[model samples]
Target: MITIEGVDAGYGRLQILFSVSMKARSGEITAILGPNGSGKSTLLKTIFGQTSVYNGSIKLDGVELSGRPPHEIARLGIAYLPQINNLFTDLTVRENLLMSGYMLSEEERRKRTEEVFQLFPFLRNMLHRKAASLSGGERQMLSIGMALMRRPKVIMLDEPTANLSPKMVNTVLDVVRRLRDDHGFTVLLAEQSVVKALRLSDHAVLLVGGRVLFEGDPSELLNNKELGRMYLGLGGG
Candidate 1:
């Protein structure tokens, strides 16, 4: 499980999270829902060691993640997939997966690559295609396929469905579901699509202005007429 207790973090001197505390239980989908500047992205970044955490702890399965470098954190089984620039656009899809698994032996890379292909079979045929040449949905598939190479215990996805067509949104989200359901991977999803997110999440954390407004069952936030209408823009809440 990923645990955060009294975390205060941000870039340099500017703090975005304020005494943020929450627990993302293992093998479940934890939705981080909020408005644009409410620090959803910052919260994920804080856990991944991208932000400066002035106070509190970020622990994954009892290991302290604070003060660790990004690569070290990654090595420890926390894989972060940000909203943008998630892949090497200059490289081919095959090359991108290769780069993601550089730490593994060539034989292991081949094995994982096949596993990725099993999840995104379309990628198997597009191995030589440059990441920049794929469609938005296809690129996202490749990007996520790369993350899967590590076989991480936890995957922190920052708006995995962003900038995709409506159909593609569901497509990407289905993969998010499989991450928890099929692979038993813990998922931390930060999303702006409130209702859709709530529907998929097993647990939910509502953030407003960098603080936890609500943290409990997904249904609690979805059923709350006031908070739904006021903060989440859920119509007729």
Candidate 2:
């Protein structure tokens, strides 16, 4: 499990999160839903060690990760996929996956690469294709596959469905679900597609101006008409 307690973080001299706290349970999808400038991305960056934590603690299964660097955090079984530039566009799909697991032995790299290919079978055929040649959805898939090469326990994705067709949105969400159901990964997704994300997630965190206004089962957010309307722009259920 990933836990954040009283976390205050942001870019240097520009704090975005305000003592925020939340928990992403093991083998479950936790959706962080909020409006623009609400510090959703900043929170993920803080967890990944891209942002500075002015106060509080972040832990994964009892190990303190508050002051660690991003690479160290990744080594601690946390994988972060930002909204863009997550893939090496000029590299072949196979090369990108290989680079993601460069620290592993050749045998382990090959084994993990095959596992990722199993998760995204379409990439098996496009092994030699440069990442830039793929469609938006396929690029996203490849980005995720690269992240999966390390087989981290927690995968944090910032806007996985951004700027995609509806079909692709569903495809990405389905993969997120599979990461939990089939692979036992703890998935943390920050998404703008609130309704869709809420439908697919087990828990939801509603953020506004860097504060967590609500955190509980998605059904609780969906059923609260006022909270839904105020934060999510959803009509009364």
Q: Could you say which candidate leads in TM-score? A: 1
lDDT of each: 0.92, 0.92
Query: lDDT tens digits, residues 1-237, model 1?
Result: 999999999999998999999999999999999878999999999999999999999999999999999999999998999989999999999899999999899899999999998889899888898999999989888888899999889999999888889999999999989888889999999987788889999999999899999999999999999888878888982
Regions more than 4 Å wrong, model 1:
none
- For candidate 1, the lDDT comes to 0.92
| Alpha-carbon deviation at 219 in model 1, angstroms | 1.1
Error of 1 at 17 (Å): 0.5
Q: Give per-residue lDDT, candidate 1, residue 18.
A: 95
TM-score of each: 0.98, 0.97
Query: Which tens-of-lDDT digit does each residue in 1-237 have in candidate 2?
Result: 998999988889888899899999999999999888899888888999998899999999989998999999999999999988999999999899989999999999999999998899999999999999999999998999999998899999999999999999999999998998999999999998899999989899999999999999998998889888888889865
Q: What overall lDDT, based on C-alpha atoms, would model 2 receive against the true structure?
A: 0.92
